[model samples]
Target: MFKVLMIEDDALIGDMVKMFLKEEGFIVTRKTNGADGIEALSRFNPDLILLDWVLPDMDGLSVCREIRRVSQVPIMIVSMKNKVAERVDALVAGADDFMSKPFSMHELIARANALIRRSKLSIGTDADFNAPTLSVSAIAAAPVSAMKPAASVEVPAEEKIRLDVNTRSMRVHGKHVDTTYSEFEIMKCFVNHPGRVYSREDLLQTVRGIDSFVTERAIDVHIANLRKKIEDNPKEPKWIRTVWGVGYKFIPM
Candidate 1:
């Protein structure tokens, strides 16, 4: 069972979340303030942390930063601030994910499970594990060896961009393109959807997960980075194009 540390001052909210998490089979340790939260960290040895943005003794961002300085125990921030900038700020301060206030308990539990799964993968504890929530594109792109020959269709000739899930690598125009995890997820969103126009909001939820609250500007930055690696002319992007009023789409030429 995964252990979770929740630092939230609202007694009602704390109890509510704790009860639900316990039902999910997580061992939860609740603390009301930053000092207590910090103190509980070592004692609890939590697999993940559910931290609130506002606390009695101090802001949670500081606590998050402090924790990251010592450990990579996944930190998911809970905040009333839902603005894109505020969400980005939390992420920059060392949060692994963010949940806006009035969040559904169902989504919260699902996100926690994902974080724990990936955390285990990162620590070499679950290398063969893939979170089941990933889209169909992920399963379809797995190594040919993993799929039956009849189901392992050949890559389309018109599709210039390709992904190898077995290697977690991508290729554009027959050249390998290196990617960060965020950029890779963004690419996956496009590859999976084809002509579908995804809003910035859609990408955030799909690429980062439902619990993630992030700036649309963060998406733009990632797109820019991805273009530099894949596009022959970053100014005239070929694979990823801005949808003008909309978000972005992946168009393989």
Candidate 2:
């Protein structure tokens, strides 16, 4: 079973979350202050952490930064701050995912499970580890004639996407991009429908496979991190572009 540490000041909220997590089969240890949360890190050694922005002793962002200085364990910020800038700040401080208050229990569970899966993969514990290997001979070999199309209808594959959904892995321009499952799903949606504008509400519904409980601003945070990893220049993104008042879209190459 995966162990989770929750750093939340509100007793009611912390108890509710702990109950749900226990029911989901996770061993949860709760802390009500940021300082205690950081100290619990060494004792709990949890697989993941669920943190709140406001704490009694210290701000959660400071705790996140300090913990990240020592470990790569996934951290998810569960806060009431719904601003895009706040979410981006949390991500920049080393959080792996961000969720606003009043989030769906189902979505929360899905995100937690995704973090666990990603942690396992990063630790090389996956059963299916068929990452492609490149060789000099294979690169130098001459190309053969193109194979016949599988279907006569000739449905063109979406452009600028090189992800293997079966393996939960993705590559952009020959470089592997590491991302959590939620991030991967969001990116895949854009890649599958290039040049199609999607509002934050639309994206939350489609990508997260749920209702739009999360704020539109949260989408910006995920997009910012996505661009930092996938784009050569995040300040001027190539694949994902903002559409002023409408929303955002993927510009296929």
| Top TM-score prediction, candidate number | 1
Model 2, 201-229: lDDT tens digits are 78766434222234566577778878998
- For residue 154, model 2's alpha carbon misses the true position, in angstroms, by 42
Clashes of 2: 0
Worst 10 residues of 1 by lDDT: 130-139
**Tens-digit lDDT track of model 1 for 123-179:** 336675432222234434555354321323356544567765444467766576666
Residue pairs in candidate 1 whose N, alpha carbon or C atoms collide under 3 angstroms: none
Clashes of each: 0, 0
Q: For each candidate, C-alpha RMSD in Å?
A: 8.0, 8.3
User: In model 2, what are the clashing residue pairs, if there are any?
Assistant: none
Model 2 score (lDDT): 0.72
Runs of candidate 2 exceeding 4 Å displacement: 130-253
